[model samples]
Target: MLRRWISTLLLGLAAAALAGCSSTRLVDGQVESFSTLTALPAPATYRIERLPSQQTPAFEPIAALAERALARVGLQRDDAAPRLLVQIGVQASSVPRHGPSAPYAFYGPPWAFGGWYGRPPGVFGGWYGPPPWAFGGWGMGGPTPLYRRAVSLVLRDAQTQAVVYETSAVHENVWVSDPAVYGVLFDAALNGFPAPPHGRRQLRLPLPPPAP
Candidate 1:
């Protein structure tokens, strides 16, 4: 019986490997200056706003999450022009039985011989990208079998309403009747931002060539 079980496990592992290989890509860093950037001119008073959410209790959890996150970076809500304002909102949807769709990578071919050329790689290569993992079963077409869920937190400039920061954390659990879990989700979103001295770090984008 043990031998049979071992054989079955190995087969399952092989099947998963065949279905897809895992890979990660770093998002482009867009922040030019973390230090001066995260620092606001010291607002006259800090204010927290909760965007309307279907979950009535979501706002409180979001507030707690923001408070903790701000404290970590040596910011307090009471300060004035007080330089910054935070908005927190929560979004939940029924476990749709499918995971999120992954976007494709765009790789411009080298301009060799004065022009570009190449066929886009297929899904299996993931050079094209991961196939949409259905929540309950296979691709989007399959029957729902599992749960799909996520939460997001956003930060914006008080004056311009331009988003200066944001973060999201996801989990595959049903979104119902769990206040503790919601708070934790907010914390996870807070983890998405850089703190204090670390905040000064800039996202390094490829610099353009200097004029000839």
Candidate 2:
């Protein structure tokens, strides 16, 4: 009878874990942001800018996600007559689920840009990968891979063209479809925009279901 009770308890625990994993997944994004402005200018109007490499139609979805994040932070997109020019950059890759390293595909280019999170010069298409931590593992330690995603937002003065606010966020998960979680990652990056915290921080948020 004791053995049977033990078996039932183990089965119940397993089932609960499965349900939790199948439900909304939690995303832990590492966020680092910097800014010079204490508050946005009057009207808080801006336009989205992209690099030459990010001008493709394939990048539109990612850009749209960033725009949504900006709006959430009380910024408006005004291309006709704007006060700020917010540039967006993103990076993603797939790695071993157990945090092992192999030849992985990296998005973006190797070119360097000033005011990034200081992750070498390769700061395009991909998140500036400096943190060596991965959480919320999937596949139950099986052969399924993990996905690493990073996003960077650069807010500049529209008239002077000088960078005023810079921020980025990175997250790792088993979900390969980025659209499902990119929105939240952007939210983490711009958590306290205009006057964000000084050091890196960890953010935990629930991932919404994929769009129907």
Query: lDDT per model, in order?
Result: 0.40, 0.71
Model 1, position 12: C-alpha lDDT score:
81
RMSD of candidates 1 onward, in order:
16.7, 8.1
Runs in model 1 deviating more than 4 A are 1-45, 52-58, 79-81, 96-149, 174-177, 195-212
Worst 10 residues of 1 by lDDT: 108-117
Q: List model 1 lDDT by residue over 1-212, tens digit each.
A: 99999999778867766663333212222121122244444542446654443234423544564576566555577634444566554433332333466332222221101011133211011111123332324443554432222345455567887766665544443222223333444455544344333332222122222225
Which regions of candidate 2 fall more than 4 Å away from where they truly are?
1-14, 97-105, 108-142
lDDT of 1 at 24: 29
As a whole number from 0 to 100, the lDDT of residue 99 in candidate 1 is: 43
Best by TM-score: 2
| lDDT tens digits, residue span 3-88, model 2 | 99999977886777677657877789999888888986787999987788766666677777788888999998999988999888
Error of 1 at 34 (Å): 11
Candidate 1 TM-score, C-alpha based? 0.40
Pairs in steric clash, model 2: 90-125, 91-125, 91-126, 91-127, 108-125
- Residue-pair clashes per prediction, in order, are 20, 5
Report the number of the highest-lDDT candidate. 2
